[model samples]
Target: MKPEVSIVIPSYKNSPLDLENLHKNIANLDYPQVKVKVVNIKVSEGKKRIGYAEAANKGILRNKSDLILLINADTKLDKDLLKILVGYTRKNPEVGIVGPKVYSMSDPLEVSPVDLPVLSFNKFFGKMKKVDPLWLENKRKPFSVAWISGSCMLFRRRVWKKLSGFEKNYFMYWEDADFCMRTRNLGYKVFLVPNAKIWHRSGASIGKDNPERIYYVKRNSLYFLEKYTLPPGVILNGIKTTFLIFVKTLRYFLGEKEVSKAYIRAVFDYLRRKKG
Candidate 1:
């Protein structure tokens, strides 16, 4: 018998059309609907919007399936995506987390980052590249990755419990990386199953250019970099933070004040060790 599966989706003010479309997609999926449980934690437009980390944790904890899938509401999982991801995990007992090869919804040719080396603050600014020859060749099989994007990840219940779910401190950005690192440290494999794919509207949940989004990303990155790297990482993070502050300062004078302040506040808030 196929193992029970639960999809935990964290959504914030997504359009009804999108929600209808998501359910429509889910309807088309190859997995048996009877064996699959879908949990949608829709967030209201409140004065304080809950973070994805917090929302996702709630959803994961709400399920009791053998396999828990964390997927974004702004994504279209291929018909076979869930089936493939579950198949990969079931065949490889050592695997704790697995995600599909994600394609940008706007540009199908573009592949999202997953198979890169473990994240370090210094390499965080590397340019995004398109699918290369190596990427295509590897798509035929599942491959281990440093981290899988939180946009869509499948996790075993035991592993989720062991890691205590996403670090609520992250609140949103980079929590996926932190989760994957902890998963790897516990001697479990985190895989990117290229055979399984999804089209994602990245940053749709949080405004792509929102000041709040920038703040969380910059601030949360500091926590991740600080915890994962040694002394050198701290030094690099400081340098990068300084550079960002300077850049944002210039932007402040150039009429990009709100966004600029977001970046500035991110540095200060990280220094103060503030979190959700």
Candidate 2:
């Protein structure tokens, strides 16, 4: 018998169209023992907006399957995506989480794998890059990665229980990295399944470069740094990342003043939260 899999999609009212497409994609999957559940924040709580972590946790708590797959409403999966992900976990008990080789909806041929966290210029950032076609053709094996994008992730139900679901404090960003880091610390490996393909409408729910997105991303980066890094490293990285945010503010000052203000407010917000 196949292991049961539960797919949790956290979405809002504005994402209904995209959610419809995602539903169709999942409905056509070749896998038989799969359940798809959508937790609509707007409809469930009578609120227009809710944190991604909270919405995802809602769906997770309702499901009692052997494996759980968390995917974005704007993502469309290939027919075998679930099958491949489930296969990986069944084959390797040590593998805690598995994510697919994602492709941008605009460019289907391009391989957009989630970047591993990198420390550059004395600051940390997710380093995403399109996979070279030649390199992809040469290397077909699934490889271990530091972290995978939250757009689409699969993990054993036991692991989810162990971590107690995503940290509710993280409203939107850095939550995946936090979960992956905790999984690694607990001795479980994260892997990327090259054959399981997913097409993502990047930033579909939240417009690209929107000020609200800027605020949450900047605020959460600092929060993640504080939680994961040592005292001196956290302080140093905070300083370096703040400098980068300053550069961003300067660049957006003229055309997008709100974005600049959001960046500044993010720092203040994080600082205030730290103090209290």
Candidate 3:
């Protein structure tokens, strides 16, 4: 029998067109025994929402399944993904979390590369490359990662309860990595299920280089490092990353694009304590 799978998508109020697109993609999935839970969080009122953590928490609370799959609103759901994920869990009961192979929509075949420097360079260059064929070829074997994309996050309900869900303090960034670390600390493995795959529209929920993204990413990096890693290493990494971003921004400026400018503006906004 198939394990009950609940797909939870947390969405903020978006243009009707975008929502239509998202609905169409998820509906395209031909998976059976799936329950879809969409949690729409409105940003009005005095209530302060704690970003993805709150939205995901709400969605999880409303779901009724032993296997909970947290999907981003901007992802194209792959029907076979559910079965693949459940199969992995069934085979490896010690595994607490699993994420499907995520491809950027612009370059669908480009499986995320193993080289951090190359991946980071691509982000700086703003060029999406096709996934390395070797990476795709290795999907048959189950492997582990320090973290996985939250775009297609899957895990057992019991494990999620044990970890107490995402940390609300991290409004938008590093929360997934933090969760992976916690799971590992508790003596569980986080695996990347390559057979299960999805395409992600990068930065769909938040526009690219949006100041809000910068603020949360910056603040959350600090929070994550402080809370989970050695202070010296975290501080050093933070400084190094900031310096590299600065250099990359300058390089982009000479190449002519407002994206670089936007990125610098965001950094300034974060430093100046700009909200949202």
What are the lDDT scores of the predictions, listed in order?
A: 0.79, 0.76, 0.67
Please write out the lDDT profile of model 3 over residues 164-231, one tens digit for every residue: 88776666766776787788788998887778888777676677577566556765655555565555
Residue range 216-253, candidate 2, lDDT tens digits: 88899778777766677776776787787778677776
Model 2 local distance difference test score: 0.76
Error of 2 at 238 (Å): 2.6
Check candidate 3 and list the clashing pairs: 110-131, 111-131
Screening candidate 1 with a backbone cut-off below 3 angstroms (N, C-alpha, C), the clashing residue pairs are none
The sequence of per-residue lDDT tens digits that candidate 1 reaches over residues 1-276 is 677888888888677777779888988989874467677876543676677787888887887887888888888989998889888898899999998877878877677543232322233433223345345545677777777678889989999889888887887778888898899889999887888888888777677899988998889978877787777657766887798788889989999998999989988998998987
Tell me how candidate 3 scores on lDDT: 0.67
Prediction RMSDs, each to the true structure:
3.2, 3.6, 5.8
Cα error of candidate 3 at position 257, Å: 14
**lDDT computed for candidate 1:** 0.79
TM-score of 2: 0.86
Which is the better candidate, 2 or 3, if ranked by lDDT?
Answer: 2
Positional deviation of residue 244's Cα in model 1 after best superposition, in angstroms: 2.3
Off by over 4 Å in 3: 33-47, 112-138, 238-276
TM-scores, in order shown?
0.89, 0.86, 0.76
Worst 10 residues of 3 by lDDT: 115-124
Q: For model 3, how many clashes?
A: 2
Ranking by TM-score: 1, 2, 3
